[model samples]
Target chain A: MDHGEKRLMDKNQESLFVRLIPFFERYGILLLILIMIAVLHLLQPDVFLSWRNVTNIFKQVSWQSMLALGVFMVIVTAGIDLSVGSIIMLSLMGLAIASKAGMPWYVVMLVAPAIGFLCGMFNGIGITLLRMPHPFIMTLGTLYIFRGIGNLISGGVPITGFAEQIRVIGNGKIKLDVFFGEGAREYIPTSLILMIVIFFIFWVFLNHTRIGKWIYAIGGNPGAARAAGINVDRILIVVYTLCGFLAGIGGLILAGRTNSAYPNAGLQSELDAIAAVIIGGASFFGGRGTVLGVFAGVMIMGILRNGLNLMNVSVFWQQVLIGSIIILAVYIDVLRRQLATRT
Target chain B: MSDNLVLEAKSVSKFFGTITALQNVDLHLNKGEVLGVVGDNGAGKSTLMKVLSGLYKPSEGSLFFDKEKVTLNSPRDSQNLGLEMVYQDLALAGNLPIGDNIFLGREPTRKVGPFNFLDHKKRKQLTEEHLAKLKINVKSADQKVEELSGGQRQAVAIARATAFNAKIVLMDEPTAALAVKEVGKVLDLILNLKKLGVSVIVISHRMDDIFTVCDRVMALFQGTNFAESELKNTSRDEVIGWIMGKKD
Candidate 1:
C-alpha cells in the first residue's frame, strides 16, 4: 500500500479499538464487582460462594439497594437527598399504623408509596420553588424534619405483627429446580426479583426516555440545558418526586421483611444508599452515572457486608472498609473522566 | 424583497433585570442567502439569536417566520417551525454517538403498536446520507462526537440541522474552534447550505469568513444596528469601524 493508504489502514485499526472501548467503559464497574466476588470466593471458598449465603445477602440488601437507586438519581442531578432514610422510616411507620387500623394489604402498599411521594414532593417544592442552593441543605433539613415526624408518630417505639400477605413480599423466596449434575434445587428471594425489576425500569428510564436524557443534560450543565429550553424546574421536581416514591417502596419492603414498622426502621440508610451510589461510579460533580453501575455498586456493598458478617469482622472495621471503598470509587470516577477528556 | 425570506424579526428587544441586552433589533434573512452578523463581545449578538431561535423570549418584540407572526416559546417550538440554532458550543453531547447527537431530541421513532422505539438503522443510514450530501466524510456514524475532530463535529451539527428540515439556521461562531484547513471545509458547507436553499445566519469575529461566504454583512455595536451592506460593497476597514463603535 502507498503511504497514505497505509496510514488510513492504521487509523481504521485504531478506531476499531475505539469502538470496543465504550463497551469496556460501560461495564467497568460490573467487571470490578466480578473480580471482587472472585477474590472473596478464593479467600473464603465455602461460605462466600454458597447458595444459602448468596440468597441471604440478596434478601438482606434489596431494601437498601432500592434506596441506593433513589439516591443515584438525586446524585446524577448533582444533588443529594439526605432525607431518603427519613422518608423510608415514614413509609414503614405510616404503613404500619394504617395496617393496624385494619386497612387492606393492597391499600397499605398503595398508601406507603403515596406518603413517600408526598414527602419527596415536599422536598422538590422546597428546593425548586424556594430556589434553595444545594439539595444538601434542603434534604438535610427535610431529613431532620422527617426523622422528627417519624419519632413523634411512632413514639420512638417499634410496631410489630404486620399482616402475613404484606410481609411475604419482603421475606418470600421462589425455589427453582436446576439441572446441575442432577435435579438440584436453587432458591432466589422475591426481593431479588423486586431488585432486578426496579433496576431494569430505572435503567430504561436513564438510557431510553426523553425525560431521562433531559435529567442527565440538566445535571451535566443546567445553564446549557436551559439554553436548550428544557423545563429545568419541572425536571427537578420530577426527580425528587421519583426519589421519594422509591424510598417509600423500600420502606414497605423493610417493614414487611421485619414484620414490624418502627421510627428507626431506616436509620442510617441514607448514608448506605449514598455510599452505594458513590461506589457505583457516580460523579459528585453530576450528570454521569448508569443504573447498571448503581446496581453492581449496591451488590458490591451487600457482598462486602455479607462477607464481613460471615468472617465476624467488627462493625467498626466494616465502616472503615466501606468508607475507604467510597473514596476509592469516587477517585476512580475522577480518573476515568480525566482520561476521557484528555484524548 | 426575496421570495425566499425564511426568517424575519421585527423590533425584537430583550432585557436582563435592569440591563438591556438587545434593543429593538430588526433582522431579516432569506432562503439561500448567507447573512453574516458581525459584532464585538457583548454586542447583544448572542441575545438576538437566542430570541430568534426561542432560547430566550424577547422582553419586547415580535418575530415572523415564513410570513407568519409567531411566538417561539421553546427550542422544540423553533425546531418544529423549521428553525435551528448551532451555538458556538454546538450544544452537542460529546459522549454520545454522532448519529445519536445529530438527532438528539427528535430521534426518528418506529412504532410497534403504541410503543415507539428509536429507529437506529434508519438514523445511521440518514446520518451517512446527510454527511455525504454536505461532502463531509467520516469513518462511521457510531463514533462518539468526542472522538471526532472539531471540523467533524461542526459537520455533524450542520448535518443535524439539515436532517431536521431546518430552512433557517443561526450559527454562532461555527468556525471559532476549527483549524485553518477545517475552516475552509466549514465555509464550503455554508455555501453548500445556500445551494440547498437554506437560509444561514452566521455570527463570527473572523472578517475573512464574513467576506468569503456571507452575501450581506450586518454590524452591531453596543446593542444597536450600526450598518448593513452587501459584503462586496463594504470595505473590511468600514466593517471593523462599525464593530468598534467608530462613527466615521
Candidate 2:
C-alpha cells in the first residue's frame, strides 16, 4: 500500500478506544488505584487517605517492586522464572546462616545475592544448554529443587535472629529533619531508595543499551535474532542470573523486615511478581514490556492490598480477590493479543 | 571465469539423515563474476548457497577461498572470511532501526569502562554514508527496517554486507517477493555489486534475472550440478531443460 493509503487504512482499522487500550494497559493499574482512592475518599476520606495507610502501602510494595523489575526482564525475553521465590528463600537462608556464624554485615549482604546469582546461572545453564521446551518448565523444576534445598538447610523452620546491623537496611530509614519544619520528621527507607535507584538503572539498561535490544529481539523471534548473530543463550543466562540476584536482594529485605526467614517465605511471591508484570502489559510470547509499566503494576497491587486492608477486607478474601484480578488481567491480555493478530 | 578465483566448492555433499540435500555439487565463482544458479524447487540451489555461506557445513568435500582450503564451522566463520549471505528472509531484526540491524552484533561503542554507551551519532553517520555510497534510497537510519518496502530492505542487507567488506555474497531469490519496480531495483543492485568487484552466487528460478545479469549460469537438479556454462554460450532453453533433469 502507498503511504497515504496505509495511513488511512490504519486509522480506519482503529477506534479511539482501540488505540487507547495499549496505553491504558500500561498504566491501567495505576489509574485504577487512583480511581479507587477517589471513590474511597468520597466514602471514608478520613481513614482511607491517612498518612499511616500511605506509608503502609509503600512499605508493603517496596520489595515486590524489586521482584517485578527482575520478572520484567525475563518476560521481555518470553521466559518465565518460577524460581524467584525459591531463590529468595535460598538467599535469605544463606544470609541468615552466614550472619549467625559471625559474617560481617557487608559480607552477608553482598554474598547473599551471589547465592541467588548462582541459582539463576544454574537455571540458565540448564535451560539454554539443555534446550528445554520452556523456561517455565525448567524454572519450575528448579523452584521445587531450590525450595527443597532451602528446607533441608533450615530444617523446615524459619531462621531467626539476624545481626542488628544487617536488619537496619530493611528496618531503618534516613530520618528527614528541618525540611518539613522544626521538629517535623519524615522517614524514608534505605530499601525504598535502593529500589528507586535500581529501577532507574534497569530502565536505562533495558532502553538505552544494545544488550536490551538483543533481549527484545530474541523474545520477538529467536530464530531471526540468531540469524542476525545474537548470542541468545548468553543473553538468556544473564537475564535469569539478574532475576535471581534481584530476588536474593528482595529476600534479604523480606528477612530483615519480618525479623525471620522461613522456608515458605516468599512462597507464591513469584506468582505475584509475574502477575504484576503481565498486568503491566508484558506478554508471555515476549518482545514487549517496560520497567515503567511494571512500576505502575506494583503500584496497582500495592494499592489494591492497601485499600482492602483499610476497608477491613479479610486476609483470606484478599487472596481470592488478588487471584481473581490476576486471572482477569491475563485473560484480558490474551484477548488483546488475539485481537491484535486478527488485524 | 577469471585468472584469479576467489571461491570454489569441490565435491561438496550434505545429508539430512539419509536424505541427500546436496551431493557432489562442485561450483566456482571467480572474482567479480555474477554466478547464477537456477533450478526448480528441491533442486538444492539454496542448499548449495547455505553450505557456501556456512549456514551448514558440508558433510563431504572441501571449500577453498583465495586458493586456500578452509573449513567454515558457522556463519561467523564465513563472515570472518569476508563471505556473507543475504537469505530470502534478509536476516534482519524488523523491530530495530535500519542502522541497528545493519550493525546488529558489532555496534560501535564509546566512553569505555563502566560508563560506556552506544555511539549512536557515529553509527548513524557511518550507516548513512554507506547506504548513500550504495545509492540505496533509505528514508532514515532511524526508521525500522520493517517500515521500508521489500526492495529497500534488500538493499539495506546488501549495503550492510558491502560495508563489512564482503568479497563473496550469496543472495537467495532477493527479488522473489518484490513488486515489478522493486525487482528492477534489486536487478540494479546485483549489477552494482558486480561493478564493485564483489563475487556473487545468486540463486533464483527466474529465467529473466539469470539471463540478464549472470556472467555464468550453473544449473542444478536433484542435489547435483546438471550443467555449467558461460552465459554467452548457454541457451535459456538448454539450461531450463537441464534444470528439469533432461540429459539429451
Candidate 3:
C-alpha cells in the first residue's frame, strides 16, 4: 500500500476505536464473564464444557441468586439488608417446625414467606418510622435478633425429614429425554427454573412499572423523590419487605436441598449476595443496575467457583481471589462514574 | 379576602428548637400575578417557601387556598391542592431519564392482567409534546437528567412543575446556577406561566430576574415580612436596602 493510503487507514482505525470506547465501558463486566468462561474451558475442557457441570453450576447458584435479586432491590434504594442471611435461617427453621407440627406442605410454603415478610416489616419500621440513623445499623441489629430466635426455636439442633413435596421444590429436575443422544437425558433443576422465573418477573417489574421507576428515583436522590411527592418511607418499607420475602424463598430451597434446617444455614450468605449484586454493576449508592447484569454476575461467580474446584484450587485461595474481584468491581464502577462525569 | 387572591398565609410562624426561622410572616399571591421574595442569607426565605410548599408545618397561623382554609401536612398534599415548588437544588433524580423525572410521582400506566405497567410510549410521546410546547430544546425525553447542562436541568424542573397545570408555582432561586443567557429563557418561562393564569412566587437573589418577571416585590428581614410593594412603586435600590437591613 502507498504511504498516504496507509496513514489514512490508520486514522480511520483510531477514530473507530474512540467511538467504541463507551460501548466497551458499558458491557465490560459481561465481556469479563465471557473471557473467564473461555479461560476455564481452555484449562479443563472436559469438565468445564460438560452440560452436566454447566447445569450443576446453575442449580448450585440458584438459591444464592435469589438472595442477590432481593439485595439488588434493596441496594437500588440505597439501603442494605444485613438481616437477610439470618432471615433465611429463621424461615427454614419456621418451615421445619411447621412441618413437624402436622402442618400441610402447602401451608408450610405460605407460612415460610409470611414469616419473612413479618421480619422484613420489623426492619422496615425500625428504619422508616423510628427514623434510625442508618439502615446498616438497623438491619445489623435484626440479623442477630433473627439468628438468636432461630437458635431458640430449634434448640441449636438441625431439623430433618421434610415432606416429599417440599424436598422436590429444591432438588427436583425436569428430564429432557429428547435433547441428548439416544438413551441419554438432560436434567434441568427445578430450583434453577424458579430462580430464572423470579428474575424475569422482577426484570419486568423494575423496567415496566411505576413502582419500579419510583425505586430508581428514590435511589437516585431520596430528597428529590420526597419533593416529587413519593411516599419515600412506604416504598422503603416495601423494598425491605420484599427482600425478606425473597430471602424466605431462598431459605426454603436451601432447607429442601439439604433435607434439614439448621439455625446457621445461611450464615454470612448476605456477603455472597451483596458481592453478586455489586459485581453485576449495581452501585453502592443506588439507582444504577440491570437485571441481566445481575444474572451475569451470579453466573460469573458460579463459574469461577466451579472452574476453580475442577482445577483443584484451594478454598482459601479461592476466597482471596473472590474478595479481590469484589473490590476490583467496585473500583471499576467508581472509575466509570468519574469518566461519565468528566465527559 | 379578595376574589383575586389565589393563596394567602395568615401570620405563619416556624421554629426549629430555639432558632426562630420565621415569625408571623404573612404573605399572599394574587391570581396570575408574579410575586418576588427577596431576603439575605438566613432571612427565612426558604423557611417560608417550605411552609407554603408543605414541607414544613407552621407553628402558628393558618393558610387559605382560593379563600378556603386548608392545611398542608406533606408535599403530596400541597401538590394535590395544585401547588408545585421548584427548589434551589432543582430536586431532580439525576440518574433518571427526563420523562421519568418529569412524571416521577404521577406516572401514566396501563393495566395488564390486574397489574399496572408504566406506559413507556405514552410517557415518551407526552413528554416530547410538552417539552416542545415549552420550547425546551433537548435530544429526547429518554436522555438522563445528569447528562443535561445546569440550564437544561433547571428547564426540566420548571417544565415538571408547570406541566401539571398547577394553580400556583413557587420557585426558590431557580436561576441561581444558570448561565446569563439561560436566565433570560427562565424569565421568559415565568412570564409564559403568568400569561396562562398561573400564580408564581419566585425567590431570587438576582434583582434583574425579579425586575424582569415579578409584578410585586416582597422583602423579608430577620424572619419577618418587612415590606411589600408593586414593582412600579418600588426601586431596585430601595428593595436592596430592605434586604440589607438598611430599611424596615
Candidate 4:
C-alpha cells in the first residue's frame, strides 16, 4: 500500500488534516455540540447559557434521548423503527386512559412500557417471520397502524392525566435549598437524571453483554452473523422490541410532563429521534454507533432548537433546519464509511 | 473406513425442489490429514461444504464424526461436534475489532455477582496470543477487521476458525482471492493444523495449493463424485482431468 505513487502524493495533504483533527473521526458530533453552544451563547448572550436555560435544554432533550437510544439499537442491527414516535403516542394514550379509568398510578406507569414492548414485538415478528423484504416496509406500515389505533382509542382528542408519580418523574426537580439559599432555587431536573440512568444502563448493555456484540454483528453482516451460528431472527426481534419499549418510556415521560396525552401527540417526533441518532454518528448502514455519540446528537438537536428560539428564529425555519441537519448527518456517515474502507 | 478417520459423509444428496445440487457425494477426512476438494463452478463444491457445515440439510445422507453416526441440524450442532467452517466471505463483522470478531459467538465474560460483562483484557490478551502464534501482524488486536488488507482479513478468519479447539476445519476457497504471499501463508496454516492432529477439508481450484498442503484429493463434477486419489499416486495432470470429468 505504501508503494503506491498515489499514497505518496496524498500523504502530504492528509497529514495536515490528520494533525488538525485527531479526535474528529470518533468525537466529531461532540465537537459540533460544543461549537453550537459557543455560537448560541455568543449570539444570545445572557439567555443562552443561564442556569434555567441550561436545565430547560436538558429537560427538552431527555425524552427525545430515550427514543434515540431505542432507535440507536435498531439502527445498530441495520434496521429502522419509524414507528417509535407512533409507539410513544399509542402507549401514552394507553397510560392516560388507564389512569383515567380508576386504575392505580403504579400499574399504568408500568403498563406504558409494556405496551411499547408489545408494539415492538409486532414490528419484529412482522419483519422476521412474515419475511418482509426489509424492516422499513413493516415498521412504516405499523407507523400508520399504531397511530390509527391511538386515534381510535383516544377519539382523536386529548386525554388528561392525574398521576402525581408521573408528574414527578417528568417535571419535578430536586432543589438545592441549602446551596442556592431557597430563594435562588437552583436544581437538577428529574428527567435529566432519568435520561442519564437509562443511557448508562443501555450503554453497558450494548458494550459489555454478548447480546450487545451480537446486535452489532447482525448489523455488520446478517449473513455472516447467521453463518457464525448467531440467531439473526431472534436478535432482530429483540432489537425492535427494545425500540418499542423505549418509545413507550419516552411517551410516558412526555405525557407526564404535559399532564396529558393528545391523540396527535408525537407527530414527526420519530423523525427528530432518528435525526438525533444520525447526528450522533450512527450509520444508517448499521454496525456502528456509540451511545455517547447519540447523546451528543440529542444535545445538538436540543441546542439547535433552543438556540434558534433564543435567537428569534422562526419555528418553521427550525423545522427546515433540523430536517436539513439529518440529511447532512447521514451524508457525513456515508463519507465516513468511504474513508474507513479506503485505507 | 479407517479408525483414524475423523469425519465422513456417506451417500449425501441435496435437492432444491427440482434441481439436484448433490447426489451420493462421499467425502472423508482422516485425522491429521489435509484433503483438497477441487471442482469447476456449479460443481457442488460449495454445496457440499455448506451441507457439512450444517448450513443446509441434505435431502438424504448421514454424517459421522470419529466414525460415529451424527446429525448436523444447524451450525451449532456442527460446532458442538467440533466442525468449523471458514467461509468464503470470511464471515467476519467488518465494523468490529479483530478481538471482537474472533470471539463473537463465544465471548469471555467476567461474572460480577450474577451479571456477566465481557472481559476485555482477557479477550485482547488471548487474541494477541492467537494472532502472534499464527504470525498475523497488525498494529493491535483492537484494529477494526475492515481496516485490514485482504490477506490480513483472511488471517483473522483463519485465526477465528482455528481458535476454539476445532477437530476438523472446512475452508471454502481460503486462498481464492488472496495475494501470492498470503496464499503461501494459508497453505502453511493448513500444514500447521495437520501437525496439531486436526483434520482439514479445503476447497480449491489451484493445483499448486493442493500439492503444497493436501495429502489426498477429491473431485466433484455436476453434483457427483468424479475421482479420488492420494497425492503420492496421482499427478497434477490426472487431478486436472478428474476435475474435468475424467475417470479411472
Whose DockQ is greatest here? 4
Docking class of 3: medium
Q: Mind listing the fnat for each candidate?
A: 0.07, 0.43, 0.93, 0.88
Off by over 4 Å in 1: A1-20, A177-186, A337-343, B9-26, B40-51, B54-64, B67-80, B137-139, B146-155, B177-181, B221-225, B245-248
TM-score of each model, in listed order: 0.88, 0.85, 0.90, 0.92
Task: Name the candidate that leads on lDDT.
Answer: 3
TM-score of 2: 0.85
Residue B8 C-alpha lDDT in model 4: 92
Question: Which regions of candidate 3 deviate over 4 angstroms?
Answer: A1-26, A181-183, B1-5, B8-28, B42-44, B54-77, B179-181, B222-225, B245-248
CAPRI band for model 4 = medium
Error of 1 at A169 (Å): 0.8
Question: Can you rank all candidates by lDDT, best first?
Answer: 3, 4, 1, 2
- Candidate 2, residues B87-189, lDDT tens digits: the string is 7878776667888878876778777577667788989999998887777887678887767888998998887777788999999998898888898888888
What clash pairs does model 2 have? none
Residue-wise lDDT of candidate 4 within B1-248, one digit each (tens)? Answer: 49798899999999999999999999988999999999889999999999998889899989898889988888889888998898888989999999999988889999999999999999999999988776778888998988887888988898898888899999988898988878887788788888878889999999999999999999999999988989999999999988888766
Tens-digit per-residue lDDT, A228-329, candidate 3: 778899999998998999888998888778889986798999999999999999988999998888898898889999999999999999999999999998
Quality of model 4 by C-alpha lDDT: 0.89
Comparing 1 and 4 by TM-score, which wins?
Answer: 4
Q: Per-prediction RMSD in angstroms?
A: 3.6, 4.8, 4.0, 4.2
Please list all clashing residue pairs in model 3, or write none if there are none: none
Native A-B contacts reproduced, model 4: 0.88
Docking class of 2: acceptable
